[model samples]
Target: MGFLLLAGAITAEVAATTAMKYSDGFSKIGPSLLTLLGYVLSFALLAQTLKTVSIGTAYAIWAGVGTAAVATIGVTFLGEGLTVTKAAGIALIIVGVVVLNLGGAH
Candidate 1:
């Protein structure tokens, strides 16, 4: 359940970040409201996960996964260019998160 909540938090954060691009600096009412709502829900869900999960582990996974997902979304759907360097950076983020979790376990 904790992991599930963490996943929800990551998802909400990614949604919020993606919607922010469409918010037009908060000048657009609809997407702006969506961005705000998504962030609120994301933090709320993350708080729930903290009840059972270690903050270090939960946050590493949340930020890392959210970042990777958002980067992918940007490249795939937002016409952002995907370069070899960007791919390597994403891979490094994933590996770093895994290493953090493994280190935290001991």
Candidate 2:
């Protein structure tokens, strides 16, 4: 259940971040509202996730996955360049998240 909530939180966070890119510095009404709503939903779901998942594990996963997903989106859809260094950084983030989860399991 907690993991499920965490997934929701992560999705919401990703959506919020993606929307933010289109928000035109909050001058665009629709995307700006979406950004606000998405972040609020993300935080609410994350708070619920903390009830069952350890804070360290949940936060690490949240931050790491959200970052990786956003970076990927930026490269794939936002016309952002994906240099070798960027790819390596994303790989490291994933690995770090996995390591945190494994360590937290014990």
Candidate 3:
């Protein structure tokens, strides 16, 4: 249940970030609203997730996965460059998240 909420938060955050990219500095009403809504939903879900998950573990996973997913989306869909350094950073984030989960967030 907690993991499900965290996943929802991650998905909402990623969607919000993507919408932000298209928001044109918040001048575009549609994407701007979407960005706001997505973030609101994401945070709400994250807050619910914290009820069962440890803050350290939940936050690490949320931030790490959200960042990696956003970066991948940027590279794949937004024509952003995927340099070796960027790839390495994403991998490291993933590893860190895995370590945190395995280490036990008690």
lDDT of each: 0.93, 0.95, 0.95
After superposition, the stretches of candidate 2 with alpha carbons farther than 4 Å from their true spots are: none
lDDT by residue for model 3 (5-95), tens? 9999999999999999999999999999999999999999999999999998899999999999999999999999999999999999999
Model 2 error, position 83 (Å): 0.8
lDDT string for model 2 (1-106, tens) is: 9999999999999999999999999999999999999999999999999999988889989999999999999999999999999999999999998887777651
TM-score of every model versus the real structure: 0.93, 0.96, 0.97
Off by over 4 Å in 3: none
The clash number for model 3 is 0
Query: Which residue pairs of candidate 3 clash?
Result: none
Model 2, residue 94: distance off in Å is 0.4
Residue 88 deviation, candidate 2, in Å?
0.6
Lowest-sum lDDT 10-residue window in model 1: 97-106
Candidate 1, residue 32: Cα displacement in angstroms equals 0.4
Question: Better model by TM-score, 2 or 3?
Answer: 3
User: Global CA lDDT of candidate 2, please?
Assistant: 0.95
Number of the top candidate by TM-score? 3
* Best candidate, lDDT: 3
